[model samples]
Target: MLSLFTIISFVSIRLAMQHLTSLFKCQVFTALVCLLLMGLPGQSYAGKILVYPVDGSHWLNMNILLLELHKHGHELTVVRSSNSWYVPEQTKHYTSITIPTSHASNLEDPEYMAAFLKRNIEIRSRDRSLSSFVALQQQTLTLLMEAHNASAHMVRDILHNKELVKSLKNARYDMMLTDPGFAGGVVLGRYLELPMVFNVRWITNSEGHFAIAPSPLSYIPTIGSHVSDKMTFVNKLKNLLHYSIGQYIDHGITRPLYQGVISEFIDPNTNIYSLMQGADLWLMRVDFVFEFPRPTMPNVVYMGGFHCKPSKPLPPGLEEFMQSSGEHGVVIMSLGTLLGSLESEISEIIAAAFARLPQKVIWRHLGERPSAVGSNTLLVDWLPQNDLLGHPKTRAFVTHGGTNGIYEAIYHGVPMLGLPLIFDQFDNMVRLTSRGVAKVLEVTALDVDTFTQALRDILDKEKPYRENIRRMSQLHHDQPMKPLDTAIFWLEFVMRHKGAAHLRTESYKMPWYAYHNVDVLAFLLGSITAVALLFLLTCRGLCRVACRKRPRDKKTKDKVQ
Candidate 1:
């Protein structure tokens, strides 16, 4: 009986041991499979990203970009202020940080900045009078200073924030993309040692195509450069003067303050514009259709059409209204962000212009109803601009020449009647006009008669401008990839390569004079001066030697001998 019991116990123990060993092996195999899957790039390499918008609510372009990027599986962190009107409802997808921007907006008061700059320039230029030169100098200084301050504050805040900084340290980003309007993005990008990219709201004609700095005077004032198609001598001088003054302000005041504040959080090596200089990519939100042909930097990528992704379904009475306009086509009218036809006179003039047009007009009038709007015209506070422009029935656009408006029209292959108001709108219209894709009508020159005639001529039988629009449409779409796809491809490409060092060539790799195109003139001037000095020295030596050892003249020969 004892032997039988021992045999039973041993068999039971052996069976239990075998089952335990099989379970252990299965668990190990499962863990190894998980590790292998996670090791793959598509699973493990999703990175952290931060997007900073200066005017977050008004940043329609950047907002659309955020949507597109979110769709790509990026973990985005948006840092905006409380005053910003547009808030994303879905915070689950993004890590939204709402910072108080009282300091930010206060830093941008135009009058205070302008006055401070005026005083500074008055002290520097020794001109008490508020002349146009002084005015220009003051305005330029104000813009630069505002930009400098905003950037400094933003950088300091981000780097000093215990949570933000800690997050950055723990979870390094793959890239930083921003609108140039945000000062801190460039600064923070540098601090975090990530690749930086810029999205310009305005297109460039002379002010280095599409990368937003201060608005170039040639474009701002609507003045064409007679000297160089890119920039006039005066424009170049203005840019230089602005840059010098700005650098002085930054180095003298802004940098020290920023460095002191930021040192407590980040490394001391961060300089103003350090991130911008270190950027691996710069994608401009400028479409070729809006800007005139000019010099372009290799780092600059035009991606204006990327954000033209349309919103939801069209509102009531839009489709039928467009259909009733006729088989020929319809015209859409909108004055962009800043300017509005709120004033009675401007509204009346616009109303009269639309009334005279035979084509149906969809006008975005933000103010009170005009006493006289034609049966063919429909007025709304806002319109689905991209959707409307993309419609086959849409023909010509009457606009204030905002970059967004220009790109939408171009993307839809519609011609324009640009009535530019302020800022780079004037330059945008000029480029569109020069390209023959659009005609420009000055806002100051607007009247019922001229506006109507211009609209008629564009929609008329000649159709020269329509052909231009078609050509540009083809060029815009003929790219190897869509603008959004291209941007995403490059962004991911940079991340995969751990920041594209090959793309970040030092601006000074070519000599300074060569970079600025001053080498030829510098060499010529240097050569001429050297030759002149040699000639003068030779003449002086010859004169002295002749006096000392020349054959005596007839009058003085006997005396010399």
Candidate 2:
């Protein structure tokens, strides 16, 4: 009985030891799997992204890009002015930090922005000659300077806020994303020693483009030139002159203003262009379809339609209006956020033109309702512009040719009749018109009859415009991923590759003459000149020797005779 009990006990002990070994192996395997999974793509790569936005439209553009990153598990923090646009409630992943500044608040106020724009428009309307253009440039520079001053104050406040800076430093943000419109991002990024990605809102300013890549003034049009890559001699001359003027303005006027402001917070030696050049990526808000074909650096990514998204259901009123339009369809008219309302005379003319159309007009009017608006026109304080354009009933769009508006119209295949009111809108309109996708009307010369005729031309006579827009729309959408996704992928790519410094072009570091090889041309010219001079001197010396030898030979012959 004792031997049998001993044998059973030995077997049980062996079984227990085997069980323990298996359990230990299972835990080790599980840990290995967990570590492997954690190291895999899309598993453990969440980064904190900081955004600095200038205003509502700027925020709107950045928000779309950040939303995608947020959806992918990145944390986003936005630093904005107190009076900037309201943050959407659905942005649960976004944290907003406000800089307190009455100047910033007033700058963002619709009335204030509108007033500033109106003064310039009034000046342009009164004088349309070269003087007017110069004056407009001066006025624009003044406004920009004022805005920069306000932004500088705001940035100073943010920098001086020790608590905020401490918290931000503690957070250890992975990257800084900014519009670069106000140039505050450059200062902030430099101060924080963070890699920056510039979201250029429009076609890059000529000087800024020169600082980043090879933007030849001969072919590449200046920001407001309204010319194409293929230029006439006169246009090329204009482009060169325009570029020169812009450079002077930026360097002579704007640079000082930015320097004075930015110097207060960061190193006074660091200029805005240097900070901009140091950026890891430049996400230009332009595409080849709308912009002229030009050589771009690897770090520059074209994200034209980044703001475009799948259309949501329109508001009840807007939906009802669109559905009721039946076969006539609908027209969307908006001047965008910058201009709150048109002059009363211009408004009346636009209203008169819309009244004559068979299509229903949904005009975004902020001021008092125009008395001339007919039954066919629906005036609203705001409109879901993209959603309306996506609607099947949307036949045409009358707009200020803002970059966002233009992209939205192209995305939805809606034809446009553009009345450019300010700055780059003129160029945007000209590009669209050149592509056979839209007609541009001069607001200064706007009359009821001309306005109505232009509207009719786009809405009724211009079938090709619709077709061209459709084609462009298809081209814009025909990509490996949507533009928003493309932007997100590139953003994440920068994060994954640690700034993608390999993609930066050497041109960014080169001086203007060196970048375009003007120095090489000069060197070749100098060499040729030196060679010609040496040859001339050698021939002259030979001639002098021959002359002296002949005289001596004649003298010797005469003496012998």
Q: Which candidate is the best by lDDT?
A: 2
Give the 10-residue window scoring lowest on summed lDDT in candidate 2: 201-210
C-alpha lDDT of all candidate models, in order: 0.66, 0.80
Over 360-478, each residue of candidate 1 has an lDDT whose tens digit, in order, gives 99988865889878888898877888889988888899997877788878877889998765445666776787788887875644688888888887887586899888889878877
Q: Residue 388 error for model 1, in Å?
A: 1.0
Q: How many backbone clashes does candidate 2 have?
A: 0
lDDT of 2: 0.80
TM-score result, candidate 2 = 0.84
TM-score versus the correct structure, for each prediction: 0.71, 0.84
- What lDDT score is found at residue 288 in candidate 2? 79
